[model samples]
Target: MNDDLKQAAGISFIEQTTLDRATIRTAYRPDYGAAPAYKSYPDAAVLELPRAAWQLSEARIINLLQRRRSLRTFAETPVSLHQLAFVLWASQGVTALAGNHLLRTAPSAGALYPIETYVSLQRVEGQASGIYHFDTRAFQLRLVVEGDQGSGLAAAFLGQQFLGQASFCLVWTAVSRRSMGKYGDRGVRYLLLDAGHICQNALLAAEAVNLGSCPAAAFYDRELNDLLGIDGYEEIALYGAAFGAKQETTTPLAGR
Candidate 1:
């Protein structure tokens, strides 16, 4: 192999190599305490989401798994608030509570749940076009920025035009300290894995409801974080996905 290729492959192995337990415990611990598991916006206008009916879909789990694909094209149909609620629930809905701790639809390392979900609402019924934070604990949307941001969001996502055509986009961010307290540098890895789990739930949920979704990682980091009004240091954007009704040509995946 060429020298450059060998160097690139070596970097991958270096990153994935496990650290000794003693070094992990002593070298990586932060001086400060861990961040809170959940975030809240007190002054932002709150819109209570409808309770997600734990309704069963006719689509078998195996079929949903087999047919799941990255779909970028969206139809002109506006997504109803009910459908939006289902997608959010499937992604991060709190399923149970123990004392003060909460369990969600997606699994997280140490149950830290470092990832937070934000939505850029473009064409949802009965909801204004704006940016909103998913208040997972309360199952509500806290308005962050009001008014249509679809065009700007598309720009932030590296000019992916399909984003502007979708009804809404799910933006996932990681609050590093949530996982760092326990896992230290390794927490960053867990944060990414947790994001994948959350986005996968969203994709499957969208497909079950006859909606189309496409997970995207290509974007300008600083620009997207700035647009979401999150500080890039403590919290940063990690993953994103656009979802909406599929065009007529897109066959329904639930039955297959």
Candidate 2:
């Protein structure tokens, strides 16, 4: 019965604007070498902690979960490039060693990796404000929308005030063909599920790094797709999250 309902509603909800009419071509290329290189072992100086302090445990994860919350207000303080990089790596960083397949903090439909991350930077210290595509395979950011496109995010979130002040906004988009080829009509559910998992990773990662954020599921899909130069139908926006320094402390992980 659920499958039948999904199929019936899919036609109206899943079908989107055609790609050819929606995508905006650009001379964008991702920069991989610009990111900081890791030496295979954690550096005490860079992490700002003792080597033993970096170890993770079930208690640590639970503590982080307890402290996690949907932080809406952010201070004007800028996030460092390292913080940005760490969050990106935690959310969708490659982890698998065999087959050279990139693993995310989330599960995917047969590991097809349909999710594409697009970033809207506003107040990062070393990075300029603009839209960037996270090249998870290479662990780098590709320039997409140039200049301070923070105002554009307001349109994406239906003029929400919280988004306007966010240091950065993460947009999750799907390459439908990647999943559709495997699951047919059922692929749509997989795409949304994968998006949720990735976003949750980001939220937790933000907490781990002392940054705060929240996922924004309600959005103007067409506007977000247009700003990111995505075709609403083929490669579409599935979810979004806003991150920055918290303005004040609140109940942790309350919104998740």
Candidate 3:
């Protein structure tokens, strides 16, 4: 983990690039230390989903809502590329118009939209396992991590085995500046609330597409932020939702 990479990843902790080399080396042990960036954030790129990706119907949406539940267990079924695209689109993609700005599924305080989405791909059919930034405006995923990033996700999320088995995991991060620039301390509160709204929408969107999902808040903060190349203070992990097919024997929930 070098200082140059930290800056590109939008990390805010390092004081100077030279100091980071020694700091990162000493911090390396079992769990602490900066994680290498998965990939560079590409300029805004628009993705064109096949025409068939738009074939989902309204009846399917309602059925999913009625059957909504947190699915902890997953089948070994691999999610299709189109299905992934659909949920991503439904969750935070721009759905309508509001003058010059765009509208999305979940509402935000003043529509500041402080929440950013990242995906750790594992079992999607057409995509490789890696980190990616969800470009809501372009309705596409911009690749960030270029290789299998699921293993690191499981570790960061407190050894959540289900996270690794799932086809994809969505990491919700907050860009504090977007809100804090206006609301100050209150911005912190709204930033978290906004993340919740986005996660719920993602869960519903997953159900609508016949995929299972579970929202998680338990994880190592700095570890996850580094894996996603996010600066802990400015943009950090808020929550994660694991999605995939559910296997019957995978124990949906353990007794508390």
Candidate 4:
């Protein structure tokens, strides 16, 4: 193992740190002021996604789970707008609101839901190639930056050319203050685990739609954050996944 891995392993043991009691008390305290459950881009143009008449295929949840795999190669065909919406919904769609809290498809610590989903569209039908923020509350996509970002995304991902070729890539960012405010330093762990839940949902959702997905944990952090126009300190990129139609003969996951 490398020095970084060795150092990380040394500190991996669990122990009660100085902030344990204080952080736990703060997290469980009632009536604590919290950040809004959703992030909004008010100035951007919102393209309301198609909610009626979804074209999703019939696939057993067990079958989808069994077939899930990291798909790096994608066909040149474009993903439909409906399919795009379905994947986004599965990943971070809001199901209901209870008082001040929003319940999502994935569970979150304290329902703080710190993860934000962004997309770099390369080949989605009825959508321009650009960066968009998934507005979970509104069920719309707020276009952030206009124009093609395929090559830039690939470069930011350390020359993972397949990322640029995929129909769209999901970029997940963690808003530190959302979790950290409650759990203190321990919130960092929650942030990562929450991201995993979101990504797994994306993967299974994509598979159900005959689309393939590949999760990527390695990338140039500063570069990706800059590309997504997020300050690395406050909201930073944590994970990413590329999705597109699977090549012929291999059969797209949706058709199975």
lDDT of each candidate versus the true structure: 0.83, 0.79, 0.79, 0.83
Q: Which residue pairs show backbone clashes in model 3?
A: 11-231, 38-145, 39-144, 74-246, 74-247, 75-245, 75-246, 75-247
The alpha-carbon RMSD values of the candidates against the true structure, listed in the order shown, are 16.5, 15.5, 14.8, 16.4
Candidate 4 residue pairs in clash (backbone atoms < 3 Å) = 209-254, 210-253, 210-254
* lDDT (tens digit, per residue) of candidate 2 on 1-256: 1234334333235543222223424424346566556656655545555435544556778777989999888989999888888889888998775575665667787989899998889999978889999999788898988987777787667677788789998999998767866787678788889998899989998999899898997666777788989776567788898999877546568677
lDDT of 2: 0.79
Q: In model 3, where do residues sit more than 4 Å from their true spots?
A: 1-62, 248-256
> For candidate 3, lDDT tens digit of each residue in 140-164?
7888989888788888877788888
Q: What is the lDDT of residue 25 in candidate 1?
A: 46
Residue pairs with clashing backbones, model 1: none
Model 4 spans > 4 angstroms off = 1-59, 250-256
lDDT (0-100) at residue 192 of candidate 1? 85
Please state the error at residue 197 of candidate 1 in Å: 0.2
TM-score of each: 0.74, 0.76, 0.72, 0.75
Q: What's the ranking of the predictions by TM-score, best on top?
A: 2, 4, 1, 3
Candidate 2 has what TM-score? 0.76
Q: After the best TM-score superposition of candidate 2, give how far the Cα of residue 175 lies from its true spot, in angstroms.
A: 0.5
Worst 10-residue lDDT window for candidate 1 reads: 1-10
The TM-score that candidate 3 achieves is: 0.72
